[model samples]
Target: MAASTSQHALVSAKSLCAGPSFETRTSKVGFVSVRRCCLGARKLGLVCASNSQSSVMEPAQLPLSPQSGSTPKKSSESALILIRHGESLWNEKNLFTGCVDVPLTPKGVDEAIEAGKRICNIPVDVIYTSSLIRAQMTAMLAMMQHRRKKVPIVVHSESEQSHRWSKIYSEETKKQSIPVITAWQLNERMYGELQGLNKQETADRFGKEQVHEWRRSYDIPPPNGESLEMCAERAVAYFKDQIVPQLVAGKHVMIAAHGNSLRSIIMHLDKLTSQEVISLELSTGIPMLYIFKEGKFIRRGSPAGPSEAGVYAYTRSLAQYRQKLDNMFQ
Candidate 1:
């Protein structure tokens, strides 16, 4: 009687735990019934869903190409690193900075220095930054820690006189320098009327949902502000037009810019959905690496250490570049 009572209790517990019933379909291959659970279903090559009534189950068609199974090819010898500028004075003040140029705070300076240390070993042939001082400061500070010890010089291309004055006549000195190009196209999303306001206060004044919509919605802009989509228009265009050619010619590049601007670029790089891009958040000063090869950008994520093994293992070209740098130091 005790054993029977225990068995009944077990069954009752399972019934309670199950919560809901789901219809399952049987497969022809092994007569295995599709599971009601979604966890690990993708790995097992099974896609099943039940109708609202829980009476009918259907198997979703899987892609026939099996492209997911194969490793992507690394056809080009180029790497791209994106770093959002370290915490600005406005960031410390909790102000919506937008296109307002602000300098890095003391902690922000340290963050940039730490960022430089993390990417010290990585090859950076060219540096791109926004017209903002914070971005330019981050770029310069980060380069200061690079193992290459190459000088980061601002490219003065605005006027012929400025270009001539900024020219380095010494070919050797020029070879030892990385061109830092500043573009207005890479600037932060224009925050419009919200630029100088405190974030929490603004949210309290305009409703949290409304403020969130203005800041995060892909297409909707704050009153007179640039939406993320609008920011992507110029940023991604500049990337394709100015940066792609350099990468195609086998150049490793670093871009230091604002959060929203970098998000726009990352959206393009990762081919993220509009919904996916909306949730993407980038930490200040931390550098994210991408292997740009075969016209595809494969994200390697942030390097855990300055070791080549962590990040350079993705591409033979990057490994070779690291070797060249090692030889130079020796």
Candidate 2:
């Protein structure tokens, strides 16, 4: 089962969005109609009402076993994969990208492909990406390398017509496809006036200390840009309102988003303090894994290549899934 042998498919948004009657709200970002399902849930105490208090907890690592089985039980835990988008043209040029749309550089493309290889054997039932070209590209490229061979289809909810027209006729086709939902809430922090400014030059012009405060401080925003706190407000809210339900539904989710937005989500999941999160750094195109079980998130760190025995040793379900992939493709 070479990855190239798997063909991609596009299904209608209506087919994917069919579920319990939840309120669907649509917002306009430029020309794209971002349809957000306002599926609400009670506060899990995962996040505190105040950001000042630290909620960091060292949850015990879930015990791992080598036992491999063909099918996972309904009670089996789900996997959550978080990946920062690959480097973009502005990143290579050392410019402030913020929310400005940019394509991935050639090295970024290679990085995305390599990232895909690292997690190729992992199960990915659904994907969520920021409505930006670089993040979207990274996700599409990564899925192309998945061993499962399910095509990642971007669900377009721009309009009622678009949703109605994109529906898949066959039920079997829906099973072979993964729905990719794009939301502006997952987009990078808006940099305001610094969108295209060179980072080094801005630092020099604004004074190093001031520039450092604007970029690193959790609460302080740039001249007209969003602070990390501002980014977290939307990112974490979207995670709770929209993404969490899918995970609760036993869907293995992969989020392809930008640095600041993802950092905010990580902050919530890990219960990191504002100070602790400020120091966190994420490299482009690297995938981090976490297990969501019993209403708690257990960090599994970054998964290595598919051949790495230790990577699959984290859970029986993962090991079994990997073994199944090996058997199918061998």
Candidate 3:
């Protein structure tokens, strides 16, 4: 969907679940282990700590449903978070990882956890990730710091049996679980022959200008590989077809993907020209936020951190949601 230019007010914040006794004010909140809560709750769960706190906030009313395929409503507003996966093993090694599926480095894990804490108070009903392990790991690790404590379960819809086998039997369990959909279309740009190659060595062999063009040019592809424009085709198409419907349905969505794929989506969201997009750079594990309302995407910039006062004040709804968290855990 194309973005709207007219000014629109942010929607009211929805009430999140009340659970856990973790310290939201501390920077160490991201490092807190939820292994016990997760193991006990199951469902690929990572739950927040629980205490004697009682619920004080009522759920926010909405004009539209948050179900998977609900129709779009102009009055509805939802949060859309885009996170580039943290540093992968190949990244640390300075290798071209494109579609190679490397795991995250230890620092990458920390980056993802930190990214989670920054947006823990924000609502996230659904998650979309790339088919790569690095992106998937980042998403799961980040959710561990969420204030809502809902379990994120990977939806296995690729095959009939896979879907049936992964189904939860209890309706209550479904309520506490967020669906994580993985799509190859959201994967990093394919590097073709450059996969597993060291960046410096490739640059030395191919010459710096040629290698730079292959990496940074908007439409020039490396030998037998995809260019930024080519990558944008599939990524933006998937975002429009699969993700926009969720936002339209009022579901809060998070996307964990690679630099190129996410840049492609951001180019679409921000309506950047091909030349502008080629120069865009996304730091690993830093999540960018956009408010989806009235079928338009409004870029709110990257959230600073959970402790930053302005982070909550980005919108009235976000501030209310944080206040509810404070009340629930106080």
Candidate maximizing TM-score: 3
Off by over 4 Å in 3: 1-73, 309-313
Per-residue CA lDDT of model 1 for 211-301, tens digit only, reads 9999999999999999999999998877766676556556688999988898888777655568867766677888776666555555544
- Candidate ranking under TM-score, highest first, comes to 3, 2, 1
lDDT of 2 by residue, 1-330 (tens): 111111000012223323322112111000111121111112343321321101110011101111112223347677888888898999999999999999999999998887798779789988889999999999999899999998887776676576667677766777788888788999999988889999999999999998888888999998889999999999998887667655655668999999899889877876667886776667898877766765666555456665544322145677788889989999
Backbone clash pairs in model 1 (N, Cα, C under 3 Å; residues 3+ apart or in different chains), count: 0
Q: Is candidate 1 or candidate 3 better by lDDT?
A: 3
Q: What is the lDDT of residue 186 in candidate 1?
A: 97
Q: After superposition on all CA atoms, how large is the RMSD of candidate 1? A: 17.5
lDDT of 1 at 261: 90
lDDT per residue as tens, model 3, 184-287: 99999999889999999999998999999999999999899999999999998787666776677677899999999987987777666687667666778887
Q: Top model by lDDT, which number?
A: 3
Extract clashing residue pairs from model 2: 12-166, 12-167
Error of 1 at 297 (Å): 1.1
The full ranking of all candidates by lDDT, starting with the best, is: 3, 2, 1
